[model samples]
Target: MDSQMNAPWSNCSIGYSCVKLFPPPMHTVPHSGEAQHRTSPGVEGRGRMKRGVQHRSNGRSARKTRPGSESGFEVAHDFGPAAESARHFDPARRGYTWGMIRFTLLSFLLAALLLAALTGCSRMRFVVDLVPADDGLTETVVHEDDDARWRSPKVALIDVTGLIADVRRPGLLTRGVNPVAEYVESLRRAEDDSRVKAIIVRINSPGGTVTASDVVYRETVRFRERSGKPVVVLMGDVAASGGYYLACAADRIVAHPTTVTGSIGVIMQTFNFSEGMRRIGIHADAIVSGEKKAAGSPFEPMEPEHRALLQNMVNEFYDNFITTVTTNRTGLSDEQINTITDGRVVTGRQAHELGLIDEVGDLYTAFDTAKELAGLPAARLVKYHRALQHVGSAYAESPTGSSSTQLNLMQLNLDGAAMHDQPNFFYLWDPTIFSAVR
Candidate 1:
């Protein structure tokens, strides 16, 4: 008999008839071709142990019989219950994983549908309204309107507020609305509408870039000459410099009694970080094609020649401004023009005295003036407003239906660096306000 065998890992046993064979402990196995027989009382057999024997606590095993035995004999092995339980749990775990995946996918689809419905319901735009007074004068409501306002004569009101910039840098993501584009569109709309008898140019700005101011001024003049209609400027809290430049083109310029008007001049400013950089141990070398190309670079100090060159440009702009004012206010002498256009801000009353503006009046007075100039008894006031959409716009809000109409000072200061990051000239009132806080 071959009696070589491995000991049982667990407690188990196998037998034939009444001949039981219990599992042996480790380290006491018979060698190959050797016999280790334990004879029972009721059976007789010659047996040899095999390589692998195992046991279980329950005394059950996977059974197999040995062939050609003189008396019937067997072998078996058993693993513990821990291994059997793991096999039973696998299907339930697979089902739970798939169920969670389906739930997550369905949630995302529902959320998208809800967002789409809300977006469709929030569409808002503006219409010109005419509220008739008892005295037959039509009160101008430049905001939301019903169908009745369209029946009256209309005067398109275009707002020229906030900083005016000719921002044409390629690939630049502009934060707010472009005043030039918006103003031009309003003019075009007024030009096309036969019902619009006149235009009321509402101005509330401290002015901006030279080119941008000229653009608005030229456009207003051209629109007036081309359409054979009248334009009346209504000055708000502060309409100075380029704001006044736009007003110069109008048939009549009306200002509120407290309005600050006439800061008629040009300005150019640049910062030199050379000394600061030097203290911090930084040096930069420039390779340039021309000596004047980097004239106003903040990285280096401005040269005397560059200063002279820039001053000449400012003078040219100043002359152009003087010419515009003098030509418009035909009664103003050269000395009067020289006295008033000294970059000093004045009250609307002072401006009227200086011949810079026509009258000191309120917005309704401006409407009346526009009506008189256009020869219309009553006209409806129409203001252009941006349509509300899902994406946010950073432009200045219109006067009507808006709670706040002024730019935040802190935000403007923060954007100061970006506004003055490049070299440029301006037709502005105060350039120091846009300097970095430090």
Candidate 2:
């Protein structure tokens, strides 16, 4: 009997049932004539121990008897409550809930509606591509009356604002447009348009380099001769010195009642730091071929000859300014011109009384004058700009499109390195450095 109970078990027959079985502990030995049954702790036996059958904890019927069960019996194992809960769980139901399904359906519906709404809409070209090419400037209509006919005769509006220079003005992070080039280009554009009968040059500047101002003045005169179009000047807050020089090219000049004009002179500014350097125990020496080679240098004192030489140059440029004014302003007498040309600035009303400007009225007055000169009963006002430039109306700010900031301290612009890098002659109106003696 001991040998039979210790033997390996065989596969169950066709009529029998089978389950995994474990041998009892060595300490438990069963008597030969009786059958033995074992259970886990905390579980109680529900029925008598039979020789060839085993009971399950779930209360199922007893398994069929095995072929060798008379010698040994099978064991039925139960996992606890965890296995019981897993038996009835559904994985598919947990992953796709009702709320998640509704959200997904709503998203699909919204996308379909949006697509339907956009189906028949006309496609707009990207504005980036509408930018003008390098060869030409963009023309925009800033003002048009309700009754104005389309493509009627136009009066081009050109702006000359801020410091006028031929080279690009340096800014914080980038370089600005060359004022001279921009002015010339706008004139060319206006000249080519046959519909543009005339141009209104709006000037708001305190003057700039002498050569730059002269170049613009010459170009404005050339534009009028070639195009046969009348040019009118509209002065803004300040049009003095170089600004006045350019205004001389216009056929007629108009200024606002409060505009400041007429600073007809030239200036060359310099500083001497030799005294401060001497106090700091610093001395500078220079070897020159001539005594005047280093004239007007900041490191040295101004010699008597140096002073005389600079004064002579200032006088020559001043003479040129006086000539330009007298030739354009034929209404002014020689004595009156001499009086105001002493580097004095005057208001628009005062300038009109002195025969410096033609009229003392607002912008519309200038427009009406332009229309009468161009021989047009009704015309549209247009402005020229580059791509990405905003010129919504004739009164758009900074028409020169210069991004350079003029940081002034004691009436000196800090960003004006172009003026200070070397000794330059200017037709400028700077109160700190210049004063008029009546």
Candidate 3:
């Protein structure tokens, strides 16, 4: 008996019955208003008892207990199916339930009525696109503020805005319009129209490439000679450099009082990154066939010979520009032409005073001047634009619109990379480009 009490297990002998010991079963009494359920004799029942004991040990119960009862069973309140159904059908809630139903029914009925009305129409039409498909150029009549005749003998208003490049000015996603091509097309249209007795070339640009500017100038001169129609240039906000170069082709130049005209010179821009590369311990190993083959290369220092060569070319182009100005502006003497042709920009009033422009006035003054030049008593004003382009008034923006001349480092363009790779000659007047280095 002593061994049996001290040992881990009682010794079994002949004629002696062995019994297994086990912990007493736990019973959780159900709370008031809840049905009693049997607890399974396994891990699940133990888990529940452990949770109840944990709640009691924490000085709290899972639910409210009767006064003096220690059971931690959760109270089953009136949240069952029957209680939910009774609450849903209560008099206080009936109005809200019925209102929701009525609203649903009304919405369905209204939707059906709308569908029926649409089906009863003669045609089922849907507007998928607002822009017209036709992209052809169309003539738009621009009514002037004054009493100008609305019928032909017409004055064709052609706009030359933005960079006057022969190449297309590409956008972020669009294959943009070519200023030269658009100008030529408009000129062709005016030439073909017999009723168009005169042309008013409205210029708003700081200039562009030398070749492009010359192309527009040559075309305008040819158009005037071939069509026998007088061409009058009306300078807008800015018509400088190549803008002024093209204006030289006009029979008479009319600039507004505030217009910025005449930057009559050429510019070839390039940068040298040799010093920067050297500071960073990098060098360009370019193998060229001749000594001057890599002339004006940014990878290396520009030699004195290279500088002279570039300067000679610039002087040649400058002479051509000066000759064009003098030939067209016959009223101005050599001294007067020399004074303003030093790549300086002047206002319209100053330009007129300097004999660079014919008159200082508004669009009306240009109209009167055009009429006088064409020898017409009265003429209608018309503009050529794409079919879908809106032209509500005389000052409506052109299709090839003007862009800010400020240099933007973040702005992306399709041709930007290619344009930067090659050296370009510009007649542009944007001083903001140098700000990047500063």
Candidate 4:
């Protein structure tokens, strides 16, 4: 057969295409909910619906409703026979309910134990965490040890770390617990509650605003005078400045042997960054309403007279601190007090020798001291640790938050480790006490 005869005819038809393509037929169908606006028949005025504007019904009720929005009978009648199987005992839904049932049963079992607790099962003790707040934020950490015997419910461990404005400090203030106010209230509660035999204030602070310190100080003083409750103070790492101020409220203060205590002064610090700014050609144009208004501004050089005035203010606060301490620890000579308390960091032993602290011991010893001071029967030790809550501050702002968790002796968090560290106030160190030592 010839090649052309065997091949299809279309293969040789170069001028024409083999298959023909056609376009789809065009059509339009009416869609739901789209009604174009036009002038209503016979009505010339307000009857004409406006275009390019949303048509809202001014009628008292809805003119139309969607399937999902259908009301009354539609909701009841919509479900078919399929709903009958899924009503209650559907196998698909049983697992979740079964889990809930298990959880409820477990919870019920635990409830009896809690009921046992309510019925005076074990001597219930509350651990009141009173970590000082930083930047007005409290950082209180609670701990439970394996040796339950060491835990004391009667003893309230109030943390008075920084700025004793509230019961919440150094870390817990962020959660909104005020240590000072809490102290006053707790002391009152302890005084009234026959169950709370004694109170121990765990002082681990560098002090803060004088007003804040005074607020807590006044409470402690009131607690001692009015209640006559044995208020034993256990000094943490550094109970200097305002911390010591509050410790003065206690009948006896027991600090660790190496605990740094006794700043015994007030201080305020201001930074001068003008020189650094001038080096970078940065200038400050400050406008103020008063002459002394810009006194604390670091942009300008402080006037000599202004500096003298500020120093006088510091001196007054220092005098107040000295007077307060003298009233608490009477008979100590100026030289001796200055040597011990003159913004200097000293060991608990040194503080004891200097008559700053009454003894050197932990919270356990403080508890015993509290009983001794209270003159009560067999000092029952109780630990008060508050339940953890939404503490807002970060670790940087509140070091105690993280440090407090690790109560390990050798390897602990910074804040926990700080509990045994040295004195803390850099602003108050002066030539009188530290200069000779340096």
lDDT by candidate, in order shown: 0.67, 0.74, 0.72, 0.55
Q: Model 1, range 1-438, lDDT digits (tens) per residue?
A: 222123333322322211123333222223242455453333343223443443223655533455665443344334335335533556667789999999998987676576557545334332223652222112234532243355777777777776666552221122344567768878887888888889889888777788889999999999998998899999988888888998999999999989998888988767788999999999877888999988888789999998898889999999999898888889888788788989999999998998888999987788778878888766666665644322222123452211112246552331232254666777777544544433
Q: How accurate is candidate 2 locally (lDDT)?
A: 0.74
Candidate 1: stretches off by over 4 Å: 1-150, 168-175, 389-396, 399-418, 431-438
lDDT tens readout by residue for model 4, 101-153: 99999997687578666654343323344875333222232322234233233
List residue ranges in candidate 4 displaced over 4 A. Answer: 1-155, 162-176, 388-438
Task: Return the clash pairs for model 1, or none.
Answer: 10-55
Comparing 2 with 4 on TM-score, the higher-scoring candidate is 2
Candidate that beats the other on lDDT, 1 or 3, i.e. the better one: 3
Q: Count the backbone clashes (under 3 Å) in each candidate.
A: 1, 0, 1, 35
Please give, for residues 7-119, the per-residue lDDT of candidate 3 as tens digits: 21112221111112322233344544343434435434331322222223123232334466665454311122333354345564667888999999999777667755855
Off by over 4 Å in 2: 1-136, 399-411, 432-438
RMSD of each: 16.1, 15.4, 20.5, 21.3
The TM-score of predicted model 1 comes to 0.62
TM-score to native of every candidate shown: 0.62, 0.67, 0.66, 0.55
